[model samples]
Target: MASTEAIAAAFRIDPQILEKWLEGKQPVLAKYASAHQQIFAQFEYIGGEWHPKLDRQSSVAMLDEPSQSQNAVESDRVQHPNSSEVDLEPQSTAMFQAVGIVTGAVHLDWETHKHSAIINGSTYPLFYISQKRKAFEALKAEVAATGNSRQRLIVYPRVIHFPNKQRAHEIAFQLVGFDKGQQTKQEVSRELLDFEFKLAGLWQFIPVCRIPCISIFRNFSSERLDYIKQAEPAKKVKFLKASHLPLLWKDAPCKPFRFNPKAEGDQGHPTFVTLKVKFLPERNVFSFVEQLTPVQETAPPFLKASKKDKASLRRQ
Candidate 1:
């Protein structure tokens, strides 16, 4: 008789196989009884269940020393005992198989959504929708034209927060481009699209924020005074020599960077500022605008008045 936890662990390893093993009558019961008599001795048959007691020291001893021969006996008791005991190989195989099944199921659902990309083998929840309406429309049309029966598209939105300035700068630099004057906004936008596509393949979406300058100081510089002096307006203000900056939306205008005075350390040490970012599904830019537009109210027929009244209304 095994403890409930052990039984549960066995079930988790392979439930169906265990079930099959438990079924089917065989004369092997006598061999099991003989080999594991100590195991049986520890348990008192209470009602329909076997309640284990401490009296079975020999059974406990067996547990402490697992023999390959004993495993054969255990295998007889449970289906796929060999699989359950074999190290990482079986577990990894099972996990990969499970992922494939899940991905297949997701592909069956929203395959119609064009421009939708699955990330992380359809595991992590993150996706990006194009900010353009035409892009979305094209995707929908393409999917419709293909007449594909299977769901192949799975997209998820992700929210990312930058805990420090350096990381945010790096991400922003990547999306917006680092070329001094060669990169135009359009070029930057295209680069963003490429970045989005690459990320979409691995994850649904990645929202990256600019790391706070203060955080960078806390992470790198040893002298708090040096950090403060460099940060002050009186001193030569320099962008911290870091790899990355925060990411902004493709169409959104770049805003001037500002630091929070309150965010400064209480002991005159510097701290990092945080930024928030969010990624969504890809669609056409026009469609996004249309979706965001508010409907206007039409005036009643009575509101349509004579020229004089209209003039008066205008004047009012």
Candidate 2:
């Protein structure tokens, strides 16, 4: 990601033209900017300056990792000719607010993804890695208690790149402004399913966070197969046996499950639990936020018990 000073030094272009080039929307030297995209990433224009699409971690590292001392970094800042002092610190992380729904939470160890929420119809992926887990827990509890899969959320979002996937920049949210009073609505349909299961309070390893956290997962294939085979016999469906839908608990005894990259198998038992899920495009995974009691299969109401069955029941 090219900085404003770097772009200026290399191109020697006017600030206004540079702003337009960063927009990448209207026609203004599109050929030149496109050709140079390899040299510069997609940038956003802010306060009449260029901001590169860099992840928060990388940006913070850039500020901290340099050998220069704080005084030296401060001295290197671009000084205004009229003013004696100029602070070189980059601007604060940009933020904006939106009313979104808490879709799902995703944590994948191999991908360096954790505490991330897929919100607003799965369009935004916001993550928080601070030591505080309360915000994330609050989100999970709200969804579970309300049973309304889509809870209206007031979110303050910022931009961040995937820590493992550097070139892929996306939106993130500051863990704040979770109002419990917000109304929620359930979006259950023929394709979606959900149900709950109690955790044994076991400890498990989460790869992304690099910590042993309490988490649990249940395979819903039996239920899924039953629904598919009975509801649509002609429709062909393939199951990815390795893809287990992990459950999110309201007041989970431990943190959510994390993927163990080195484990030979995903340790979990097969259960008849149904899950209400949403797909996270950023991580290419499904997150189950709400769970419901498994619906048992029953014979047709018109069917009557045979005399032999009644006799067997009497003997029992």
Candidate 3:
């Protein structure tokens, strides 16, 4: 869900990185002179503030107390649940996982070219191509069905890192939940990646801290696309792409199946997965499909292409 704007603000990289990305010049970030610390962690709302919660074993998890004041949950400082352990070294792209209560209503935003959700008083983006309308309708249905229960939306994003400015530095020092003491802070220069960074031109502030900002996939699946409900194999897969691969081709980029917030199992949590961006500079276009390597089959490969080539052809 990282929009072009968020990427610019959070990182000290090229302002036109997105444009260059679309133009087929794969943007490579400046490498750190030394190894930088990166954390893959999750957080939860507890005791009127966001707390780091890595354990997923709890069946009856309480993210918010019934009597908790709305102001606390709606605070902009603690809007995100996850934290990072990044340093001042030149930042690179990384992914983080987060869960938040979906606030406000779901609606399409043409400006950002994404469906929008207000999570904890902050705006988050959802990207769905082709069947966007269907996905939007399904999300609306789930939100309405959940009513006042306040369902949680989980997202996985590959975000770019930027140097922490004055505000970000203060927020980093203000955070209170790290398990380790000051020594840990010294070793890993922990900072809040969600803090504001400078954005110019078409780049705007993107609230989601994860993907180039946050987006949906695995946890936020769509029941509308669950046509083969009883089919064990299909159901086991977390996410599904929308197109098919060609013979001798692999790793093609395709849109994911529509999301269904009301799907069974852990009804309170909806999730989404963002695919890694890829490009073909030679072709001057995004590379949706990749050519496969040669196989060592003695006989002619008759059933080869038909085998898994239909990855995108499956009925959603």
Tell me, by TM-score, which candidate is best. 2
Top candidate when judged by lDDT against the true structure:
2
- Compared with the true structure, model 3 gives a TM-score of 0.20
Arrange candidates, best TM-score first: 2, 3, 1
Regions of candidate 2 where Cα sits further than 4 Å from its true position: 1-113, 129-131, 160-169, 182-316
Which candidate order results from sorting by lDDT in descending order?
2, 3, 1
Residue-level lDDT tens digits of model 1 in 1-316: 2333343243243333323334543333443454235433444332222344433333122322235543211101111111211112111111100000101112212353312234333322212221222333443455466664223222222222333323311110111111112243443233332223211000011122332111111121223223333332211111111112222334322222343434544322111122222222122100011111112121111101123322342354
Clashes of each: 44, 12, 22
Q: Lowest-scoring 10 consecutive residues by lDDT in candidate 2?
A: 234-243
lDDT scores in order: 0.24, 0.33, 0.25
Off by over 4 Å in 1: 1-116, 123-134, 146-157, 160-186, 189-316
lDDT of 3 by residue, 89-156 (tens): 12223222221112233554445444544434544444332212243445557656656323322221
- Please give the TM-score that candidate 2 achieves against the real structure: 0.23
Q: Alpha carbon lDDT of residue 70, candidate 2?
A: 26
lDDT of 2 by residue, 1-316 (tens): 2345656555555655555655765454665565356335544333333443334343223322233332212111111122111112223221111112333443312244334444433544444432223455676676677675453333333322222322333344434334433232322222232211122212333222222222221122233333333321111111110111222334433343344335565444212233333434445333445543332121111111223333343365
Q: Looking at candidate 1, what is the lDDT of residue 48?
A: 27
TM-score of 1: 0.18
Model 1, position 138: C-alpha lDDT score? 45
